[model samples]
Structure formats: C-alpha cells, structure tokens
Target: VDADTPSACVVEREASTYSGNRGDAPNLRGPKRSKPDASSISQEEPQGGATPVGNRESLGQAGINPVHSPGPAGTGSQPVGQEAKELLLFACGVCSKRYMCNSKLVIHKRSHTGERPFQCNVCERCFMQLSDLRVHQRIHTGEKPYTCDVCHKRFNRRFSLKCHKRSHTGEKPYKCKECKKVFTYRKNLNEHKLIHSGEKPYQCSKCSRAFRRPETLKYHQKTHPETTAPRECEG
Candidate 1:
C-alpha cells in the first residue's frame, strides 16, 4: 500500500446479514469488500479514528477542514495547494494568529512584546526578525536586488518593486472611504484620510503650529529655524 494512502482505504470485512429462514449456522464467512480507489481518496490528514477519507461531512463534524498554508520562502507568487498539507496549529498567545511552524510563532510573539533581537552593526538599529535586519543592512550596502522589468528601476525590497509595477500599470488599489479618491500607494491613502478626519497630528515644536501632514509641518519649521525652545500647540 502507498504511504500516501489513507488507512480507511484498506479493505475491511463486511458483517454478513442473516436470512429470515430457519437457523442456518450463522454464516461464519463475511462478504469480501473491494479496496477503494486511491485516486478518489482525499489527501487530508484524518482526525480521530479510521473515518473514510474524502468525506467532507465527517471532517466538518470533527471540525477539521482542509486549509492552505504558505509554503517555504521564495516559493514564488502562486498560492500553495491544500493537498496533503497540515494546517497552521501553532498560535500566538497575544493575537491568536496561527503559524505552521513553532519558530514562526516565536518570531510573531516579538511583535507584541516589542522585542528586537537582531541588530545592525553599522547604524545600531534593531529588528525583530533576522530577515528584516538583513534587509535594513541594504541601506549601508546600497544593494538593490529587485528591479523593474518595464522601467528598469531598482528597489532594495521586492515589495517596493511590486508597488512600482502598479504605477506603470496605472493600478490604484487603495481608495479613500470618504470621497472615493484612489491612490497607487497605501501611504497616500493614509495621508488623504487626515484631510477627512481634520486631525493635525504633526505640530511645529518652535511655533506651536499644527499641520495635517508631517511634510507640511517640516516645511513650516523653516521660517522659525532660529527658535530653539519647543512650545505646545494651541487647541
């Protein structure tokens, strides 16, 4: 039998049904059962006893539904298949986010704890994950691994390169909930949200003047470069 074959696929003896006619020595021999087709069997791991594989109703009763999980890193843009794969069981204590591996769960916990174990030697900046620290080191190394195919533009991060492609494609995925305004980047949509909320979070320290955006406050500070004392913003 193939290792991938479910235990339920193995042939089991069928109990013989007794005829209503006078007591014939209860047939000692049971009916022979044929083996199930391997192709028809589901590859999902069975829960509890030897329940028939590929039975969605049984799986639902056991609360064990097949779910797709992200494959190993650098597996490409396509989604990983759900066949013969284990579901994410390791969960974060803080947020209840699930991960397939325990190591991934350990790293995820750092987010809630604000723990950064990986440090950059050059600038002394800390990161929760080693991968993030390595990417941050690219600032000193000036290495842009990702490049655009259309414009030949280079970016340090793959995500930056992906966002740059949206500009070339004229794809504006982020939209403002207030006025139906669209933006190519999420940061632009976040900045536009300040206009609707009337929340001026960035304030000029010297002049006590507040602005909707940080860049506006930064530009406003140029006029009072001589002022060194920080003042509170007026309501």
Candidate 2:
C-alpha cells in the first residue's frame, strides 16, 4: 500500500458512505482563514508583534488557501474531485473535521481521544503521532535539523523554521478583526483576542490573578514564593 493510504480499510468505507448525504455530513475542517490585505502586511523591516493584514500569499505557500479549503467553513463548494476525496476521507466525530488522508485523520482523532501511541524513550513523554515523537526526541538528542537561512538559528521542527523565516520576510499572515492588528502567527492573534473580550481563562492558583494567556499567568505565579523557590536553586 502507498504510504499515504489509510491503514484501516474500515475508515475508507465509512468515508465513501459519508458522501451519499451531504446534509448528514458532519463538520469538517474547512479552508484556511482569510488573511488581511497585502498593503497591511508589507513592512520595510520585520519586527515582533501581531497586526492584521490580508492577501494570503504567505498562507497559500503553506498549503492553507482560503478558497480551496476542504472543511465546512469554506466560502464556496469544494473544487472538482474534492467531494469524492471527502467521500473517501476520514472525519472527526467531535468537530466533524474531515481529512483526505486517513493517517492525518487518525492523528487528528487523537486530539479528541487524548491517545498517545508514540512515546519518548528517554523521558517517556507521550505524543499522538510518530512525527511528533521524532521531534520530541530532538530535545534529548540535541538534534536541530532545520535552520534559519537568514540568522543561521536552528530548530528541531520545520514549522519553527518557517515561522522564523517570517522574521526575515516580514510576513504577518494572521490579523485581528477588531483592532486591525496583524500577527505573524495565528496563536498570537488568539491571545490578542482575549484582551478585547476581557476573558481571563488562566487564573493563578495562589494570588487569584486572572490572565488572558497561560504564559502571563505563569509569570504572575512566579511572584508567589512557593513557585519560585525551586527555580531559584536551578538558576
């Protein structure tokens, strides 16, 4: 069987049957989110911080096209042969997110199931996919395969290298709808969204300080004597 072939025959059958009734189809991961316009993204020099911009040239290169996205959130209907591919696709029951590749769907299913089939031999930390395990292994092995072409900094994962490349290219693909701020990555925008909503999900166990982001909460917790005692010795 081809490497891309679904390991399970049952999933292939289910995906094919899923196509019979589009109305009954569960939600699937759809196209990439639309980006802000190009004029908003262009900068003379790259800098840290999120901003809103459009034009998906950068995201398109990353295989996240807003137009051709395959999930339910797509703006238009699937392109030619996409429907058939979906029929042969595996979908997540929780989110109804579909994957054309069975392996991808299997890995995605782990997000819901919290199943970690892959584990690190050294630390015994678990991962949902073998690729993730391999990346985790890099920490123990001190292996950095991916490097930044500009600054020569190295990374264990290819995506990290890609994100670092943005520092050089000045690409900010994620944007905020309210303040019109642009972000180099989507997670930064998500963190920024909490500021506007005034939603504080990360709360300190000691001081009862609420934070929009976990990093902030973690930093705030350091002020408490109990948490910083161990780190003080390590340093």
Candidate 3:
C-alpha cells in the first residue's frame, strides 16, 4: 500500500506443511502474507522526492493518459480519449445504425422522425441536415457544381450528373425480370414492368378504354373526340 514499496504480484501461494512422524525436512517458510499496516503505509513517501513510477506505469497500462500529456492532433479543445470513446457509443434508436458522434445520430434520426430542423430562409423549405439545406439553397442561387463530361451540361446535384453520364456510357443497368428488356433509367424499367402485368393504370375519362402508358391514353382520346360535330344534329 506504500507508494515507495515495490509493486506486488497478485498470485495465490500454497502453505507448506510437514508431517511430524516422517523425517521429511520441514519447510522453512509457510506462505505468510504480511498485510501492510495502514499507519506505516500512510507515513511512507517516495525516497528521492520524485514522483512514484508505480502509479504512472499502472495508469499507462490501464489506458489512462496523463493530464499534462499533449492531446492528439486536430482534436481541437476536446479530450482525445473521451472523443474516441464517444465516437463508438452513439447509435440510432430506430434502425440501430451506429454513428461517430451524438450530433450525427441526431441528424440521422430525422429520417425516421420526419424532423426537419434546418430551413431555407428564402424558400421556407425544410431539410433534415444542414448539408441538404445548403444544397437546396443552390436552387435559388442557380449554383451548379456538377457537370457532364460528354454533353458539358451542368446540374446542381451530383445524382443528376451521374444519370446524365449514362447517356454517353449507354449503361442499361436496369433490366426487366419478366421480359428481360433493358432500360437506361429505373423509371422506364418500372413502366416496362406494367406491360408484363397488363396493368392499365391510365384510363380514358370519356370512355372505358384504358392504357398502360398515359401518352397512349392521350392519343386514344383523340379517336373518340366526344363526337363534337353537333352530335349529327340529333339525326
């Protein structure tokens, strides 16, 4: 217990015993654990007026850092050990998704809660993240950061630029599972799926005619133009 005393190893030693009848040599020392007296431990101090190595070395071994040690680079006023530990603790309640910090988890929870804290002053439109709000503000400012290399057309969002790049690449990534017809865009492929299902979602207003595509229904309406020629003057 004295700071000056050498560190003790935590091992259990068995007591040595001898039988009196046999001529076996008796053990000189039975395992006697001398407990340090509390009064003597309180009185003892480091010999050369120097700091104890046992405390410092034990702290280093237990992953505890010294208060005076320089913090890790770019930690910026935050304790590195605590920041690293916080980076692992934060997790989303709904999806169980892990994030590096509480702030990130707070932002991610908005997806489930439908919480839009950041709002645009000009448009009054709300966004879950500050980055999304910043990007939405570009719509009013007409600031386009992404550009298509093939067509040289600019777009505000990188997703638009990626879709535009497919025009030059001819990448038909979307394929119909039923007919195996390929399409460059997912929306077109979704529309193609209705053909296999024979789903006529668009119906003519004047007639019972229905079509899979809206444009086809629009064209069909032209054939039945309500007989608008005065209805044959009531014959």
- lDDT against the true structure, per candidate, is 0.81, 0.81, 0.79
lDDT winner between candidates 1 and 3: 1
Q: Candidate 3: RMSD over Cα atoms? A: 21.2
Q: Which candidate ranks first by lDDT, i.e. highest?
A: 2
The candidate scoring highest on TM-score is 1
What is the TM-score ranking, best to worst? Answer: 1, 2, 3
lDDT string, candidate 3, 4-108, tens digits = 755544221122223433457454568778887976765578566444555676467656677767777997775577566666777777888877778988888
**Model 2 scores what on Cα lDDT?**
0.81
Provide the clashing-pair count of each candidate structure: 0, 19, 0
lDDT of 2 by residue, 43-149 (tens): 53335633224535556666776676786665665556765655756777899888778888888888988999888989999999888899999999999999887
Backbone clash total for model 2 is: 19
Tens-place lDDT per residue, model 1, 50-94, is 777657688778777657544569867644555323377787877
Error of 3 at 48 (Å): 44
Tell me the TM-score of each prediction against the true structure: 0.58, 0.57, 0.44
The reply for model 3, stretches above 4 Å from the true place, is: 1-91, 97-104, 194-235
lDDT of 3 at 63: 62
Better of 1 and 2 by TM-score: 1
Rank all candidate structures by their lDDT, best first, as comma-separated numbers.
Answer: 2, 1, 3
